[model samples]
Target: MKQVKINRLSDETSAQLQLLTIKDMMSLLCISRPKVYELMQNEGLPFMRMGRSLRFYAASVQRWLIEHEQVRG
Candidate 1:
Protein backbone atom coordinates (compact mmCIF):
# COMPACT_ATOMS: atom_id res chain seq x y z
CA MET A 1 0.00 0.00 0.00
CA LYS A 2 1.09 3.56 -0.66
CA GLN A 3 1.99 5.71 2.28
CA VAL A 4 -0.55 8.36 3.31
CA LYS A 5 0.44 10.07 6.54
CA ILE A 6 -2.68 11.93 7.42
CA ASN A 7 -2.69 14.07 10.52
CA ARG A 8 -4.99 12.78 13.20
CA LEU A 9 -6.28 16.28 13.72
CA SER A 10 -9.46 18.17 14.31
CA ASP A 11 -11.66 18.74 11.29
CA GLU A 12 -10.53 22.35 11.15
CA THR A 13 -6.92 21.26 10.83
CA SER A 14 -7.49 18.32 8.52
CA ALA A 15 -8.04 20.51 5.46
CA GLN A 16 -4.65 22.15 5.69
CA LEU A 17 -2.57 19.15 4.77
CA GLN A 18 -1.28 16.99 1.92
CA LEU A 19 -2.33 15.52 -1.41
CA LEU A 20 -2.83 11.83 -2.27
CA THR A 21 -1.98 9.60 -5.18
CA ILE A 22 -4.27 7.00 -6.80
CA LYS A 23 -2.58 4.27 -4.79
CA ASP A 24 -3.02 6.25 -1.63
CA MET A 25 -6.69 6.73 -2.44
CA MET A 26 -7.06 3.01 -2.87
CA SER A 27 -6.00 2.42 0.70
CA LEU A 28 -7.67 5.47 2.19
CA LEU A 29 -11.06 4.86 0.64
CA CYS A 30 -10.77 1.08 0.84
CA ILE A 31 -11.62 0.92 -2.85
CA SER A 32 -9.95 -0.42 -5.93
CA ARG A 33 -7.92 1.63 -8.42
CA PRO A 34 -10.64 1.31 -11.08
CA LYS A 35 -13.23 2.62 -8.66
CA VAL A 36 -11.10 5.65 -7.92
CA TYR A 37 -10.85 6.39 -11.62
CA GLU A 38 -14.60 5.94 -11.98
CA LEU A 39 -15.22 8.50 -9.27
CA MET A 40 -12.85 10.85 -11.01
CA GLN A 41 -15.03 10.55 -14.10
CA ASN A 42 -18.64 10.07 -12.93
CA GLU A 43 -18.21 12.16 -9.81
CA GLY A 44 -16.78 15.65 -9.55
CA LEU A 45 -13.68 14.39 -7.80
CA PRO A 46 -10.87 16.94 -7.57
CA PHE A 47 -7.44 16.19 -8.96
CA MET A 48 -4.19 17.80 -10.00
CA ARG A 49 -2.46 16.92 -13.23
CA MET A 50 1.30 16.73 -12.89
CA GLY A 51 2.61 15.64 -16.24
CA ARG A 52 1.11 12.17 -16.59
CA SER A 53 0.50 11.73 -12.87
CA LEU A 54 -2.75 12.41 -10.99
CA ARG A 55 -2.90 13.78 -7.47
CA PHE A 56 -5.81 14.51 -5.19
CA TYR A 57 -6.09 16.90 -2.30
CA ALA A 58 -6.45 14.78 0.81
CA ALA A 59 -8.80 17.20 2.48
CA SER A 60 -11.04 17.51 -0.56
CA VAL A 61 -11.21 13.76 -0.84
CA GLN A 62 -12.18 13.40 2.80
CA ARG A 63 -14.90 15.97 2.27
CA TRP A 64 -16.06 14.09 -0.79
CA LEU A 65 -16.38 10.98 1.33
CA ILE A 66 -18.37 12.87 3.92
CA GLU A 67 -20.77 14.19 1.32
CA HIS A 68 -21.17 10.86 -0.43
CA GLU A 69 -21.45 8.85 2.78
CA GLN A 70 -24.35 6.41 3.05
CA VAL A 71 -25.51 4.66 6.16
CA ARG A 72 -27.05 1.23 6.26
CA GLY A 73 -28.21 -0.24 9.46
Candidate 2:
Protein backbone atom coordinates (compact mmCIF):
# COMPACT_ATOMS: atom_id res chain seq x y z
CA MET A 1 0.00 0.00 0.00
CA LYS A 2 1.21 3.50 -0.73
CA GLN A 3 1.74 5.58 2.37
CA VAL A 4 0.36 9.07 2.43
CA LYS A 5 2.80 11.33 4.16
CA ILE A 6 0.93 14.03 5.93
CA ASN A 7 2.81 17.11 7.03
CA ARG A 8 3.37 17.26 10.74
CA LEU A 9 0.95 19.56 12.43
CA SER A 10 2.71 22.59 13.83
CA ASP A 11 0.92 25.15 15.88
CA GLU A 12 1.50 27.92 18.40
CA THR A 13 0.24 25.64 21.15
CA SER A 14 3.06 26.48 23.49
CA ALA A 15 2.24 30.16 23.85
CA GLN A 16 -1.24 29.06 24.75
CA LEU A 17 -0.03 25.61 25.82
CA GLN A 18 -3.02 24.41 23.85
CA LEU A 19 -3.05 20.95 25.29
CA LEU A 20 -4.98 18.34 23.30
CA THR A 21 -7.53 16.02 24.76
CA ILE A 22 -7.50 12.25 24.35
CA LYS A 23 -9.89 12.48 21.41
CA ASP A 24 -7.58 14.79 19.52
CA MET A 25 -4.58 12.62 20.26
CA MET A 26 -6.32 9.64 18.70
CA SER A 27 -6.92 11.57 15.47
CA LEU A 28 -3.39 12.92 15.44
CA LEU A 29 -1.79 9.52 16.05
CA CYS A 30 -4.41 7.50 14.20
CA ILE A 31 -4.78 5.38 17.28
CA SER A 32 -7.68 4.44 19.47
CA ARG A 33 -8.74 6.57 22.41
CA PRO A 34 -7.97 3.71 24.76
CA LYS A 35 -4.47 3.49 23.33
CA VAL A 36 -3.89 7.18 23.77
CA TYR A 37 -4.92 7.00 27.41
CA GLU A 38 -2.71 3.99 27.88
CA LEU A 39 0.32 5.86 26.56
CA MET A 40 -0.45 8.83 28.77
CA GLN A 41 -0.56 6.62 31.83
CA ASN A 42 2.65 4.85 30.96
CA GLU A 43 4.82 7.89 30.25
CA GLY A 44 4.87 11.54 31.19
CA LEU A 45 3.95 12.35 27.63
CA PRO A 46 3.56 16.09 27.99
CA PHE A 47 0.30 16.18 29.87
CA MET A 48 -1.41 18.71 32.04
CA ARG A 49 -4.66 18.47 33.98
CA MET A 50 -7.59 20.79 33.79
CA GLY A 51 -9.54 20.34 37.01
CA ARG A 52 -10.06 16.63 36.48
CA SER A 53 -9.51 16.30 32.75
CA LEU A 54 -6.34 15.18 30.98
CA ARG A 55 -4.61 17.42 28.46
CA PHE A 56 -1.55 16.62 26.37
CA TYR A 57 0.93 18.90 24.64
CA ALA A 58 0.89 18.49 20.87
CA ALA A 59 4.58 19.22 20.40
CA SER A 60 5.57 17.18 23.38
CA VAL A 61 3.75 14.17 21.99
CA GLN A 62 5.65 14.42 18.69
CA ARG A 63 8.94 14.77 20.51
CA TRP A 64 8.11 11.94 22.86
CA LEU A 65 7.45 9.49 20.04
CA ILE A 66 10.65 10.45 18.24
CA GLU A 67 12.73 10.23 21.38
CA HIS A 68 11.41 6.94 22.67
CA GLU A 69 10.86 5.12 19.40
CA GLN A 70 12.10 1.54 19.19
CA VAL A 71 13.61 -0.46 16.34
CA ARG A 72 12.15 -3.76 15.28
CA GLY A 73 14.50 -6.70 15.32
Ten consecutive residues with minimal summed lDDT in candidate 2? 8-17
True-vs-predicted CA distance for residue 11, candidate 1, Å: 12
Clashing pairs in 1: none
**Cα lDDT of model 2 by residue, 1-73, tens digit:** 9999987545564434557888888888899988877787786567888899988766677789899899999
For each candidate, give its TM-score against the true structure: 0.72, 0.64
- lDDT tens digits, residues 1-73, model 1? 8998976787767664677899999998899999999999998788889899999988888788889889999
- Number of colliding residue pairs in each model: 0, 0
Which regions in candidate 2 have their CA more than 4 angstroms from the true location?
A: 1-16
Candidate 2: what lDDT?
A: 0.78
The Cα local distance difference test for each model comes to 0.86, 0.78
Q: Relative to the unseen true structure, what is the Cα RMSD of model 2?
A: 11.9
